[model samples]
Target: MFVLAAALAATLAACGGGGGGGGQGGEDVTVASDIAYPPFEFERDGEPVGFDIDLLNEVGKRAGFTPEYQNVTFDGIINGLRNNQYDVAISSMTITPDREKRIDFSEPYFNADQSLLAPGDAGIESVDDLGDATVGVQLGTTGEITAREFKDEGTINGEIRTFDTIEDAFNALENGQIDAIINDLAVSQYEAKNSDGNAEIIEVIPTDEQYGIALPKDSDLRQDINEALAEIKEDGTYEEIYKKWIGRAPEEIPR
Candidate 1:
């Protein structure tokens, strides 16, 4: 099934003329997203709905294009962009030097940090407490990268498991299959809040990362998207979206 999907994406990429003629008119722009991370991007009533979706829709309106969303796994998003499988991506992806080498990004949109989530009674207070406990993280995310860093530095003296999605990692933690989960702070908090005492955020790992709208390297649409993003931020649309999805007004908007 995965192979067939990949083939279809490739075929679509080859035939879609790069998915929108460089932001001209109201062209349908192909968008790639891991549609399971809530508050950022997720599915509701069989349609994608979240901060990223709302923000991107507004962006499209101003950028003169319509975004045609494509649901995909988080790990595959970057590779898909590199292969021209999608025109843009807005999956709460952090802007990093390494990733910048492979793809371009609009200005930073959301500030973020890593967090440690575990059962409420796990007795884990911080990363230092997980001596030999299993740590779960979503595959290819900065959370996974942070976990590996801890393991390499002897901070985490245990197995580091990778899940296809953050939801999967949360399930493992809930089922006692893993001791804890390392993931984005906001997403972890969302899960913990909805867990009904099953889980809680044990610690916030401060990385000072920022999310950005990803684009194909050297994409012509970058300028249009960035301008639209700037407009959204300036006219208070960004704040409204932030408050709606994040449940509070942003303390500071990412630059």
Candidate 2:
């Protein structure tokens, strides 16, 4: 029962916590991740813990495979998947047309949009007002893509600094190296709230993006993953996990 215009919701609890190589299994699945994006996939106590980790663990259990998470850079993750370094990957990756040409995606798991995080006093109320203000973004992310769009469209005639992680982007903003950070709403908000008043979300850019797990093209695991995801939702496991992490049940998670 998936819908085209569904609203995204989330819940969560810590699951699949660890950072390193996967153990050999009958069907070994190496899941590549950036391991820095929070509320989705980030390291805690030197281990991975977040929504994607928890969800993927359950999906693997239902799909009859062992899942192992490998930490990789956001820009390098796709290539790693293509080269067979990873059996699959999930790190809050948005399902985009350009990406689909090289890989396969499971059903959309989370709905997301872009956001601008700036100092509380920046007077940047909307994306339209970003003119002449430097923006920081994580390299190889939709945030970077959107920032470039703003520059190309003349919405902002300022510098765009690319960082390896969202944390670095936020640090740049706090240190005045940049004026704003354009990132996913949930991520930006989480960062800002914990920034000790150094950052605040100023604008929401509606892009209607959906996050999906990425797999190598022609991989036989795609359908099984999809089926497991469906079962997770149907059995209410998704809701419980969403509530644990997102603090609320999904209103309309895709399918």
Q: Pick the candidate with the highest TM-score.
A: 1
Count: clashes, candidate 1: 0
**59-173 in candidate 1: lDDT tens per residue?**
9999899888888999999999999999999999999999999999999999999999999798898999999999999999999999999999999999999999888888888
Clashing pairs in 2: 11-241, 11-242, 11-243, 12-241, 12-242, 12-244, 12-245
Error of 1 at 159 (Å): 0.7
Cα lDDT of model 2 by residue, 137-244, tens digit? 999999999999989988899889899988788777889889998999989888887889888888889999999999999888999999999999888898988888
- For every candidate, C-alpha RMSD to the true structure in Å: 5.3, 11.9
User: Whole-model lDDT for model 2 versus the true structure?
Assistant: 0.86
In candidate 1, how many Å is residue 197 off? 1.1
